[model samples]
Target: MLRPYREVLARPGALAFSSAGVLARLPMSMVGIAIVLAVPEVYGSYGLAGQITAVYVIVHSIAAPLLAHLVDRHGQARVMMPALRVAGLGIVGIILAIATAAHPGWVFAGAVVAGASIGSVGALVRARWSYILRDPAAIHTAYSLESALDEFVFIVGPVVATVLATSVAPTAGLWLPAAAVLLGGWMLLSQRATEPPVVRREAGASGGSSLRSGGMVVLTLVFAAVGSIFGATDVSTVAFADELGSKKAAGTVLAVFALGSMLSGLGYGLRHWQSPLWRRFAIGVVALACGVSLFFVVSSLPVLAAVMFVTGFTIAPTIVNGNGLVTSFVRPDQLTTGLAWVGTALGVGVSIGSAAAGAAVDQQGAHGGFLVVAASAAVAVVATFVALPTLRAGHAPAGRGAGPADYATVVPNSDPSA
Candidate 1:
């Protein structure tokens, strides 16, 4: 398990950028729960909290692909540095608004700014991996490692956010994400050696958007459903723990969930799959649906935690395969944009799920939110089966710039010896 990861990280600048990427992407896990905890405590309404979070996530979903396009056109440092600054300001605005008891409109405005500018650091990092590594097997291992790192982020971020929110100050939880973004963004952008070069288009050339591919569209929608499950689970678990008078324990429960995924991700990376990527993705989605359905029946915190851990087993494998399939559906030039679409779909689903679960929690408590989770999973299952034909025919159309085969250029220091 460690051998593959060691080989990948052995490439010069790989360890540096990936480490920085993890730091920068920490906000991905922290921001949702921080907002969920802070807004309700300050405003006394879970519905309002959810709405604010929805606004942020929805705008993020809209903005990430656009930012990624810019990155593809220009370069990561040039685009992401300014975007990170704007996002930092937005977070500051949110913190100030909440602290000063400013009008709700201020919060909404801040959310919009923050959401539109945060950009998908996860996509950015993965793009770096794709740029630097040439081997298909190496790429698979790298993605799996990133997924596991993502789980690690989730494990630590929520616990810190939850503790700060409940024990120190609600606003305190939001601060860490903001700080991480600044520090991590700088660290990542400063390492220019591993960044993917901008792929300029020929005059009059039109490769079009990655969304033009039917398979990509199908994958996006299915990912949206998966994202909804994530959103619903986060809000529901928080509420459930609160209801049981052990709110702090929400972090621990969520950590357990991530632990399962992280462990699985580590194992999944080591395998050499003989099956098609789409088939693996579909199976993972089905397993995820079945696992989440169990959430609807849990009556205690321990039971919920146990179910979450089991359900988590399906997440990383599903995501890694879905990302792998992106290469199958889009041109090499569209890699970043394509990956950002996956993140965008997830953000959109999370917005919907957060708002829906928030409303449901307000009406029927924690279990209501769990209902949304199960429902979202069911939607994912349906979408996956219904779109099976399209997913199986995963090649992009001809004249789409070049297929992912053209994606594997030899970047400097890509070798383990380097």
Candidate 2:
């Protein structure tokens, strides 16, 4: 298991950029929860806090692809550095507004700024991996490592944010993410050697978006459904714990869920399978759907936690393959934009799923929320099968045309022709 990770990280500049990326992307998991924790103390309204957080999420989802496009047009450092500064300022503005007890409008404005500018460091990091690594197996391993890192971030970020907010100060929750983004962003942007080269468009050629590709469209929609499962499960788990008189254990249960994904992702990356990417993705989706269906039958907190841990296994492999599919469907020139779309889809789906599950829980309890989770998984399964032909076509002849041999061969570092 560790051997594959070692092989990938041994690449020049890989460890530095990937480590920096983990730091920078920490804010992705932290910001929403931080806002939720910080806002209510000053404003005395959970409703207001949720609304502000929603603004941040929605704006970030809309802005990530645009920023990625700019990165493709210019370069990572040139675009992301300014964006990081703006995001930092936005966080500062929010903290100040909260401290001063300023009007709600200022808080909303700050969220908009922060969201629009935070960008997608994860997408940027993965783009770098795609640029530097030539072996398909190495690329697969690298993506898996990143996926595990993401789960690790989600596991640790919230606990730290929560502790700081409750024990230290309400505004303190926001400070960590702000500092993290700045420090991490600086570390990543300074590593010029690993940055993907900008591929300029040809004379008179159209500036086509990644979404125009059928495979990309299918992926975005399917990932949206996957995100919905995540959102619904989170809300329902909290509600379920509350129902069982063990509300404090909710965090533990959720952490177990993340742990399952982290472990599976690490293991999944170790393989050099001969299976087609589309087939693997389809199987992963179906497994996730089956895992989610078990939630409806869970009756106790202990059982629910166990179920969540088992279900978590399906999350990372599905996501890893979904991202891998982007490399297959999208041109190398538009790779970052295509990857950002997956993140955007997940963000949008999370928002929608959480809202829908919240409503369901209100009407019928945790079981109702689980119903939503099941429904979302079912949708993902349907979408995957329905678009099987497109996925199969897109994944056939990109870089992995020769199956396991592609994993053995290493192409040169120069960019492939657009």
Candidate 3:
């Protein structure tokens, strides 16, 4: 089952890059939470505290593609080194500011610096693999494995962050991701001897500018829908736990929910599809939608766990397919930037969804939040269904539609002649 990953990691620099990904992400998840815990010590209002946390994610999401473009244009090591130190310094500044109760503005500013400096390591790491794994099958396998590893990061990063916040100072754990980015970037640079050289693939290609490609537009829509649902579902699940009068159940429910996703992602990595890309993707959509719908009906924690477990089955493969489409639809050189665009889209969507879910929980209740989740899934289903014909053809119709163009024209690799 693990042979494909084992085979891929055996290649020069692959393992090193993977380790860098872990190091970079370890602190990434906790960055927002750290802001939440620390800002409150400075300011009592939760809203102000939440804003400080939100700024980091919002800024990071907006800045990721720009940073990725820098790396795409320059070398990854060159772009990442300075950014890493900035992030580390930002972490220390935040710790000092909050410890001294100097100013809330300083805390917010430090968070932004940390965020902006953290460049999208996931995107950077994936781009590295894209340059190395040229074959379609190998690329798919690499992406699936990388995503599974990412899930592990999300799972572990949060738990560790929570523990650190509880046991150590919240600011202390902040150093991990910041330092990891630098450490990992340096480790990755050492592998430059075996690395794929940088390219200007757009310098003389014959395709029109990538801005109007159909695949990219579809990807944005798909991710927006999926990510929003996740954000809403997470907050809603906690709300439901509260509704049941078991506040502690929130953590238990979430763990099961994540466990479901982790196991399903594992299955997705190991299983080979016998169908076409669009067909598999469509099936994944159905599974995802069904899972979303189930949340509203299941009230008991155990049943919710069962529902969540079932719901988990489709997420990893759907995302894997969505990412796999990137290579097929865009030029080879644009892969990292393309995926960065998609990941950023999902991040934005999740932010919106989580916000909406939080509001729904506060106003309408868990049922209402769950309903919003179902509705979001329905939107994604409709969006993907409408795009299926064009998707199945493996390319857009006569003229490029929105998806391809959306990703293609963006920074990092955008050019008219390409």
Candidate 4:
């Protein structure tokens, strides 16, 4: 399990950028919880805090793909440095507003600005991997490791943010993430050697838009559904814990969820697959649906945690492979944007899921929200089947790039000694 990752990191400059990227992304998980804690503590209104966080998420989701498109056209360094700097300034302004008890409207606007300034750091990091490896066999390992790192980030980020806000200082959580955005982003931007080549748009090219590509819309919708499962499960888990008079159990149970995904991601990356991309995605969704459906039957916290652990087994493979599928269909010039769109779709889904889960938990109890997760996975499965023909058609006329049709076709050249 460790050997493959060690070999992948042995590539020139891989460790430096991957480490820096992880640092930059740690803030991605921190900011939400930090905002939920800080805004209410300072402003005395959870409503206002909720609104600020929602605006931040929506604006960031809308902005990420556009930022990635710019990163695609220009170089990563040129785009990332300015973007991270602006984001850092925005976060600082928000912190200052909180410290001084500025008007809620000013704070809200600052949050929007900060979110709009955030580049697609995770997608860009994955793009760097795609750029460096350039082989299907190698890229699979890279994506899996990246997904595992994501689990690790979410695991540590909330704990760090909460501890700093509660035990250290109310403003400490926000401050550290702001610093991370600046320092880590700057370090990542300094790595020029491994950056993806900027492919300028051809003069007469008609089809560069990833959104318009064949099956991409469906794929995006599937990713959105996947995101909803996460959102609904999170809120529902919190509600479950609250009902049990142990609100803090929310974090521990969620850690179980992350642990399940992290373990499975490591295992998934260590093997080579023989199925076609679409077929594997189909299998993944089915597995996800079956696993999440068990949530509807579990009644106790221990049972729920066990179900969550099982449910998590499907997430990493589904997401990692979905990303790989994007490489198969998108134009080389639009790879980063295409990948960013997946993140955007997930954001939108999470918002919808969170809202729906909140309403369900309020009206029907925590168990009600479990239905949403199962439904989401089922919906993704249906979308996969319905989109089969379009996906089989593969890349549109304009954006066809270099990806094998089947995973089995990827000749394994993973020399652990490399």
Number of the predicted model whose lDDT against the real structure is largest: 2
Instruction: Report lDDT per candidate.
Output: 0.85, 0.88, 0.72, 0.81
lDDT of 1 by residue, 281-321 (tens): 99999999999888878889998888888888889999998
**What does candidate 3's lDDT look like per residue over 1-418, in tens digits?**
6776777788787888778677776666667766676666566767887787788779878887777666655656666778777877777777788778877898888879877877777777766676666555565677777777677777776667667766887565565665666676667655664343445543344444333578677877888898899888878988898888986677666666666666666666665555676677778887899888989988687888778877876777788777776656666445556777788888888888889888887888999899889988998899899888767776522211233233333323223221
Q: Please, what are the lDDT tens digits per residue for candidate 2 over residues 37-107?
A: 88889889989998999999999999999999988767788889999989998998898998799999999
TM-score of each: 0.90, 0.94, 0.88, 0.93
Displacement of residue 265 (Cα, Å) in model 1 is: 0.9
Ranking by TM-score: 2, 4, 1, 3
Best candidate according to TM-score: 2
RMSD per candidate (Å) reads: 4.3, 3.9, 4.9, 5.6
True-vs-predicted CA distance for residue 176, candidate 4, Å: 1.7
Which has the higher TM-score value, candidate number 1 or candidate number 4?
4
